[model samples]
Target: MWAAAKEYFTHPQMESFKRDVINHMRGLWRTWRSKMNCEHVKNHDNLEDILNDVPEFLIKEDWEWLVKEKFLCKEFKKMSKTNEENRALKTMNQHSGRRPVRQIALDLEEKLGRPPTVAELVFKTYKEGDMIKDDAANERHAKILEIMESNPDFTALEVVEAILGEQKRGHVICFGGGLRPKDLKSSTSTKDATDANLEAQLRRSDEEKEALHQSVIELKGTVSEQAEEMATMKAEMKKLQEMFASSQNRQH
Candidate 1:
């Protein structure tokens, strides 16, 4: 429980509340042994772990304080299982038949006359529905992210254009400026040398297509000329045949 609490304490979202929770708990943790009338944690052996250790059993007063301060969250965060260890833990759970804790958190912040939390930014972003609904489009987006991660030079705009069609370009992305991954951040200048490789590819493909179209038009003109020459040749052959028949009739 203490380990989980420590993890939650370090989480990045809603830092205002989380920091206060940590500071308040720090006092409790510091005086835990004295408060509990106990000098040991985990069989009186783990002495190093004693520093800033939460008591195994919290007392009534502790519970009351947490409640009075509105620090105890009703919905437990489930980011412990996620592999995304570097990012902030999302506090809002999308469960059915439950009041929106996110809204409550926002309201509480407003009531307290505090600024919007990092958690609020996250909630608003999700509310905007940045995720692509189609599984295939999502898979393609993931692949694009992977490619960007590997390359590291591509800006978010380039990545978006590569991953999304023209219609879906702006909709495919919704990351913040600073918090976004290195690949997704649109820095004005990245390192030199094949920067516009994707753009070059698109331009080259278009050029090739135009050339192919021109070749097709030239081929059609050549075919028309061949057909006209064949028609003239057949007319000349008929005239020769008619002249021979007329000569034969005169001889008869």
Candidate 2:
């Protein structure tokens, strides 16, 4: 049994397996740690802790070997794991129920102190498969239109929820404005406009920064040149003063 285990651990394939297992374990530990009120752990610190905690699961000799072969330190591995988890968590949170179509619209209205338009709502929730008929998402499109006509202030996200909630036949309703190619084109154009505006603002800012930097450089150069000129003037004035004193002494 010892020989078999040792052989498996030494095998090249086992290196991949070890990485998968360690990564999974690290993920679980992070989740557990987050739920707790402990201070955030640094990568190296976390790896050291993991090594201490799971010495049996991750044989120290094998781990050291993997680290040497992979040219990755324990801390680096821990940092990589932490980064992956952070990204996954961010994605999960962003797609969470908080951003439902209806809710997003309502929030926008509340913030803007006005109702949103149907086109705006349609543009927000018009994912490719969202308009398709399924038992889970039926008659959503028609409902969105109905809601928009009825509630000018309602967000597109809100309209989607209302339609989905009221659906009975599991029939697909392509949101009239949402499923249209023109609507998509409009949305794309809107995004392009926004991007252009942002790019213009960034360019202006960069120009300002460059101008400021140049001004600072010029000021420094001018100050340095003035200092040198002042020094030369002072030396020449001292030499003239000495010559005048020497001539006066000679005449006396």
Query: Per-prediction TM-score, please?
Result: 0.26, 0.27
Which tens-of-lDDT digit does each residue in 78-190 have in candidate 2?
Answer: 77678778677531111213354435445545676654454444444443454433423234445555776776555333444454443223211223211222222233333
For 99-189, candidate 1 gives per-residue lDDT tens digits of: 3333443354457565333223223434326554556445564566576667676554454445443323222232321112333344432
For candidate 1, give the lDDT. Answer: 0.44
In candidate 2, the residue pairs with backbone N, CA or C atoms under 3 Å apart (3 or more residues apart, or in different chains) clash, namely 101-157, 101-158, 102-157, 102-158, 141-175
| Candidate 1 wrongly placed segments (more than 4 Å) | 1-195
On TM-score, the leading prediction is 2
CA lDDT, candidate 2, residue 77: 59
